[model samples]
Target chain A: MKFLKLSMSATAFAAAMAASTSAMAEEYKMVILQSLTGGAAFIGKNVADGAAMAADELNANGFFGEGNSLVYEVADDATDRTQTLSLITRLAADEDVLIVMGPTSGSVALAGANVANEREFPVITTTNSMEVIENGPWSFILTQPADVTIPYIADFTAQTLGAKNCAIIGVKDNEAYVALQRKYEDLIQAQGVNLASVDGVALADSDFSALATKIATSEQDCVFIGTPAAQGANLVIQLRQAGLDPSIPILGHNAFASPTFIEKGGAAVENVYLMGAWVPGGYDDFSSAFSTNFEAKTGIPADEWHAVGYSGMQVIANAIKDAVAAGAVTREGVRDALGTQTDIPVVMGEGTYSYDEHRVPHFGMKVLQVKDGAFAVVGE
Target chain B: MLSQQILNGLVTGSVYALFSLGFTLIFGVQKLLNFAHGATFMAGAFIAYYCTISGLPFLLAIGFSMVATGVIAILVDLIAFRSLRKRGNAEFPALVSSIGVDLILVSIAQQVSKTQVLNFPFGTFPVKFYTFMGLRISLLQLVILATVAVLVALLIFYLKKTTFGRQVRAVATNERAAALLGVNAQSVYLQTFFIAGALAGLAGVLIGLLFNSMQFLMGEPYMLRAFVVVVIGGLGSVPGAIVASLMLGVMQSLTVAYLPSGLTDAIIFALLFVVLLIRPNGLFGDANAVAGGTRQ
Candidate 1:
């Protein structure tokens, strides 16, 4: 009889503990859609990592208070546009999921934004297109747009580098790359640099021998290659091999500011001017602390993509926090809060974030260079 | 500058020739398209990349990659083509099967690579230049030129001088007749596929090292180019493929240099269309290819 009574008491105690734990808080999740397995995987993986880390940071700091915590549910679209649409629809149909953070690829992000607008779901994207903003107010972009950053890069290339004549080369098929090259062309020309060759190559162009032959024989003071890291590095190496003087500066877009660039280019990337925004010890105290804590937590080094992703999440979570405080944490409530939230402190650029009157996220910019085989801040 | 561009085109066309040789060979022997040729090409690069990173010597890595891709090509034929060939009306079904096989190989590589672009290690091939007669040429470029030249010569010699080559030609002429004459048609088909795959494999390695970028989808672009090369070179002619490849390469390079951007493909396809309209059998192809022929 005594043994039976002890067993009954233990069962009741276990049940009570379960109930207490379950009643402690409500968990809210926003989908962290990304291209974890494709051409953009480098960006997607880092972005997802930073966003998830931001969620963990919020929960640890008691920013969500005692009643709720955010969950950044991660998903991969494999860098496919069609898969991105399906993911957005499925995530939006979840009544509990109030927002979607990314489909990091520019083209895939644009497709997801269209669906998000039709579904009236709020989305924060990392794509570099102004077209996504045209999709509607329901979709928001958090990346430092090229229009704002490329001018600084172009000016730096022309003024600081003393490049009197500039040549441009990039992928003609990609709209973002074409826009970047055009912006550089216009701004560099505005700085009194005569244009030499505004050459465009195919997206799948691996053989730079033909293009490099043209550039090496051309009379340009410097050349701005607007391809991504590996391609850009290979081009630089080939151009050098093709007899372009090593003293001639190679200016590139922000995509060149990556560890992969350093790894792939090695000695070739030395002194190549690149556009970038984040580095652990390169930014403000907030960023420094965040980077330190971030490194301590995740064991992965912080990068530009990590900063963009963390800032993007803070923008989303701050709105969610406000909704929670107002006792109306619904999808529309979060969307309304996101529209009003501004000037939130972040770990990007000059250490703050906000959507401008045009509904585009704003951040500071910088120019980086490969100094002694490592990334170093050169200009802004 | 024009000469340099032509030189660049020749190097590129050499790889194009390497890529297209096998594609045309399969068509010559089997009269079926192997859409998975690109996948095998990609597989070659991936295999070479992995082998190199694992501390294999560069030449050894190239050899291993070629052999592995050859086996992969044979497997493709066995799985995707053999049954279709048995069914007698294999053209449509074989095309679909090859596509399915290509997708499977691509998907597997994607999963293995996790979609990261790969590169050969620095100094895998020495980075040295040779300047002569106001022209700058890298040692690697010379190596590529020499390698392609030797391989093409050897292939020609083998085709003209070997007994297996005779069987291959007979099979290409008429499979049933070759089989009735004890030519071992299956063996010929396998041998042709093996040779084609090995060539594509080497092309993949050279491109991966040349471009310093290798990814799962690297072969897709070449597949489209292969169609252009084969159709323009004449469906079943090796020498024609080489000439057409170099022509296409030089034309593409010059267009990129002189004309507006994005017209490279248009010019190339236009040339192909003109070739088709005028010389239906290709520049080097015999009239028998267009007239009622074997295999079809």
Candidate 2:
């Protein structure tokens, strides 16, 4: 009887230990490489916040299998391409990290894409360059490429705004701006708009007096600004002050979508039309929830990058959930699942994500205009 | 179009002249290359920006910026150049030191601004334009030109007519000898730095208002252009700086308006290189090494 009782106790203890082991959750690791401490830090901070918000929401929703959790690690790339590659390599070598997101800029994203392919790890970048996916199968981009978006901007400026002649002002010596200027040249010509002249302004030029005077006197129907936000704002302000008709339409690139432009440009940027990647007001239920929760948690207004970051992470989460459901949750499995993910719900645009054969997300954007000191949807 | 461009160039050139004058002035007095002069200029803009944001009147903001930048310039000398000057090892060491100080100032500005571009509030300056002889100019341009003219005249009068100006000239010739002659070299250095800083600050505020963009890095490009202007104008020669500044401004405007965009920088710098090669003493420069060392 004594031996039997002792055996019974040992069996109970063994069963209890097995039950405890089953109750503990398995954690999947994700690593993010973003530009957090350099020139792009402002955008980088938003990206980081959005990703964290998605991760938290996913974990809370139990989207992963029962007793499974997602964990993340973040590192700053300082907006440097070489640094991005190094960080990606380090993250890829880690067996624990299931997937990676970012290296925010296009130039840096190009390098990151190659690293993802070489290491057989998946990288989802928010870079606006379509060329990012050319690095191969494992590389993905979440934002609209400039080529796709610029045409729309040009078409709208020509058709909707009825601008006949347009002067192009761009920052010289920037590879991106130079490319943008050429794209504008092509698109404006296609729309039968007379390209008055292309003016290349130096970066950090405090006096735009000459350029402004030239543009104002050109008698163009519109001025298209192909510079970053700050420079664009100053250029427009100086242009207006130089006696350009206040009613002349000012067409802008994606960079002007930032509220900073409206704030800095003040009364001058009043009729500025911007083609932007994200439309916050177009949020679906899923996006609305993410947006609400994000603001509640971070106390910062969500911008284009916030939406992209959250969407990128949501796609990652869905892939992980599918991988977990298949009982094959390796990095390769998550990547394969991402490859097969179609029409996954997102928070930006129409709130659905579909990937091309190249694994680049279908990036739908919106036309935004600043009216009454705030951003409002154009052609609503 | 050419006339308008020329008019624009003159407006922009006046500011360049104002900036380079201070730069040459310091070199005239001490023969020291104060790299931090750009930072001093930047600080003026920053101060003026804050003052405006804090509800100070527009002209008051300008005054505050000028005074603060002037003081900052004196501090730069006390910290970066003074010890080296005392050791008589100021040339290269002072250059390196001023650069170091410049970096520090830039870093501080970056932190203060959070690496964001700032703009003056609307109505910081009234915007009105005038058309004359088929050419257009803004009220701000007119004001800038008038202000520069007045400042230049005042500077000329002070330098040519005053006892302190004579003392400064004496010290510029030979500091040790000037001190022996009871010129009080210390006061001369302080006054020259103060004036230089104040002028730079005024230029900073003007440029900031003109562009409607105030940023920590704005002074960098002006500093670079100042080099070209002072080199062309004959370093240390105030009148030479003015002429060279106007020339460079016009050249830049014409280049941008007519030449291939990529060639502007190459052309400008090539001009600088040619000037250095052909006339190392510069067009208006003295045979003496020190800027403004010769009256002619």
lDDT value, residue A356 of candidate 2? 68
TM-score of each: 0.91, 0.83
Model 1: chain A TM-score against the true structure: 0.88
- Give each prediction's DockQ, rounded to 2 decimals: 0.59, 0.37
lDDT of 1 by residue, B1-296 (tens): 88888888888899999999899888888889999999999999999999999999989999999999999999988999998898899999999999999989988887677555678999899988777776777777788889998998887777767888777788888888888999998998888899999999999999998878888888988999999998888887888889999998898889877886677888999999999999887887875451113342
Q: Candidate 2 docking: what grade?
A: acceptable
Give the per-residue lDDT digits (tens) of candidate 2, residues A273-346: 98776654334676667657766776545666777788888888888889888888898888889888888888
User: Which residue ranges in model 1 land beyond 4 Å of their true spot?
Assistant: A1-11, A36-81, A280-303, A343-347, B286-296
What overall lDDT goes with each candidate model?
0.83, 0.80
For model 1 the local lDDT of residue A319 reads: 94
Candidate 1 lDDT over residue span A224-326, tens digit each: 9998676788888788778887878898887776566777788877899888767544467888887787667765456677777888888888999888888
Docking class of 1: medium
Residue B69 CA error for candidate 2 (Å)?
A: 2.0
| Tens-digit per-residue lDDT, B1-296, candidate 2 | 78988988887899999888889999888888889989888989899999999999989999989999989999988999888999996799999999999988877886687556777887889878888998877889899999999999898888878888888788888888878888888888888899999999999898888888877777888899899988887878888899998998888777767776556668878998899899997778876645345532
